[model samples]
Target chain A: MQDARIRLFSFVSLSIATFLSVPGAVLSLGWLLLSPGTLRETMKSAAFWVILLFVTIIATATQMSGNDGLSYFIRTGVIILLGFSVYREWHPGEYLDLSVWLFGKKAGFDIGLAVEMSIQGLHEASREFARIRSALSLKGLQPGIRLIPAVGFLMIHTRLMRARDQADLLATRGYRAGGSCCPVFRTSNRDITMGILAILVVFLSFMPVRDIFILQM
Target chain B: MKLSLSAVEWNAGSWKFRADETFTPGVHLVSGRVGSGKTTLALLSARLLQPDAGAVEYEDIRSRTLSFQYPEYHITGSTLHEEAESYGVNPSAACARAGLAGRWDEDPFRLSRGELKLFQLSCLFMRQWDLLILDEPFSALDCRGKLAVCRSIGENRSGIVLVSTHEQHILPKTDYLWEMRTGKLTFRGPLPEAITAWESAPGPVRMLREQGVIPANLTRDDILEAVCRMHE
Candidate 1:
């Protein structure tokens, strides 16, 4: 049961981080691709794009091959919505108010476990970074630390450690800073179909449907 | 295209680095006080760490890779084999060379410090890079490891090796000896030339020489021979 609990959390967290990163990556690469260049310059620019496309192909192949296509989309939608919420509402601040809005402006910190874990992910990532930096400093090798590797190392340690200790937290039912709760996994074929239909609604909302409504008005 | 690094480079903190002469890569020893920017200077050359001032030039063609000191920092994969794969390093005999053959699938982070260092060292050795900036690779190694690194650094490998280390005990007979002092680095010629000049100096002036000025390559016996008249 303990092992199961850890695996569950690990799977959820890994899926969430991966899902969040896709669009972040896509947007970052999109701007890079939109560089001003001639036809020859564009071909040379295609080198970096090739690297991007290679990674995308790998990710897509894995996602499609896996049977959890709807779950993947749901995970992806949650991330995209969170990303937009950070960008649009805050405009420039970015995720500054996500913590406040995470609980939907009413309940305590642990409203839904996914929302709680999302915030904890950022906190854990930062805390692990500080811990690693402190540990390295104690060793006296005060070289400049690279951000990505430092974060990556700490992240792996943090997740693994949390995965192990998470079961104990559930047993105790204590409210820790890294508050634990069950993930809201609402999956149904009907919901998946509706989700796809919702996407189509938004897509169609941009075109003929709106024009037709305007003509009737 | 010979790019000479002039002036000093400082960033992020109070640390500063200065090079006395131009650097062409071969075997250049950057010796300095513990707090001085020996590592910073090395990182600068590697292009791993940027400088607020001063510039490292390629003259003609550009460099592609920058090696680091702590092998553990460079380990990116979950397992030893995966770590090797991350760098695209294919050791001829990975297991024997890195001593990680048996532990390929095991977590690299769980390995002992020495084992981790060896794994990283093997990966760097297998690669064909133009600039290898190793920041004190001798930190956690025995005498044999030091010799292996020195041999690799001093070899005719085409690219320049900028070794940022205070451990001068196990270095090969280097072509150039560089020292960092008071935010200024002086590039002394060869060990032979520096020892020769110091030997010819008067007793009082000779006493002024810090121990760092004379490297291990120029033994006292060699200096004494240079000082004394020994003609055939």
Candidate 2:
């Protein structure tokens, strides 16, 4: 959805549904799959399969042989798919705009700025990890348990240095505790339809659908 | 021994880099503007990054090291002493050589960026490598620190050292020069020839050429001597 508010609302409503009811969770996944190209992109990630396998293993070990195990696996899959869908559509700028629109300019701006910085820090950390890994490889050292401390220290050190520089820049720019930003949003008919569907899914989760919804194990 | 790229093509995000050049056993200075793929070429030469289409061949190379643009990325030590020791070099000696004699016991993360670079350089210099790639090594250093690094580079005769930088004025005495323009290796030749032939030579070189004085060498000292003689 182009509208940040609608997207956030839909994500939150779907998250609640996934946690509450199996049918609701399945509906949430279906809604997530409504976005074109999401399913293909999600399936392409090896991480998604790994996580699914891990959850399946846990379910098999704990429940052994029963409908409960199968249900657990299905629920876990639904949750994972919901998360993947949310991440695929995540936009830092939209989050910032939504935050600023919801909260007053000052407090909302601070929160939004923090979110933006966190996203940027994630990118930097990934790049830094690659560089550090390459450096260690060049030194004839394999990345094992021992390298964790060094990598962690370097990442923390870099973040601290960046924070210091950012502080200096903020000071130089005469930044106050609360800054203001103009919040703008554009909503479409599709966004409104998705938002209503998300609300309906959350509402459906509260209804007792044990008689109607059944999964053969 | 030589480190050469053969029609190597690499991509960084949306930008594409192509390099086809050979670096001999000498101080080779790779100069280019920002985002001109100098670092990408340096990484490829160091074998840290593989090319998408071609090969980076190392002729009879036993060991190699790549010092990244940010020195902190190369640091894996907790303390200054341990940082040097991690490279299998004497901590005290490396610290002293890096002009960080009294800071051995301190956390390396506490030191300034330039000091960290000096410390890393000292450790790298202590070991023998067939290929040394320094990417923007002159950055975040004082004049004396820069001079110290230049002296180290000038004194070394062990292996092929590739210095990738955009700093034109404070460059070391390089034997050969390579210029990257818009992701293409545009020039590769002797230093003197590069200074005279390169259309986008540094300000000092262009100024000297404009004044009808071309130095016999491309080092700062040689240029200064030539300019002094011109005045005399």
User: Each model's C-alpha lDDT?
Assistant: 0.51, 0.82
lDDT of 2 by residue, B22-88 (tens): 8778898888898888888878888888799999998998888888889888777788887787788
Q: Would you list the clashing residue pairs of candidate 1?
A: B1-B59, B18-B185, B20-B185
Give candidate 2 misplaced runs (Cα > 4 Å). Answer: A1-57, A65-94, A183-217, B197-200, B229-232
lDDT for residue B224 in candidate 1, whole number 0-100:
47
List the DockQ of the predictions in order: 0.03, 0.62
The runs of at least 3 residues in candidate 1 whose Cα sits more than 4 Å from the true structure, single-residue gaps closed, are A1-151, A154-217, B1-3, B11-15, B195-232
Residue-level lDDT for A160 in candidate 1: 74
Model 2 lDDT on a 0 to 1 scale = 0.82
Clashes of each: 3, 0
lDDT of 2 by residue, A1-217 (tens): 7887887788889888877877888888788778867677778666689999999898897687544776677777887876776665666676677778888778888888787778778757768888998888877789999889889988988898888988899899998776767877888999999999999999888888864568577
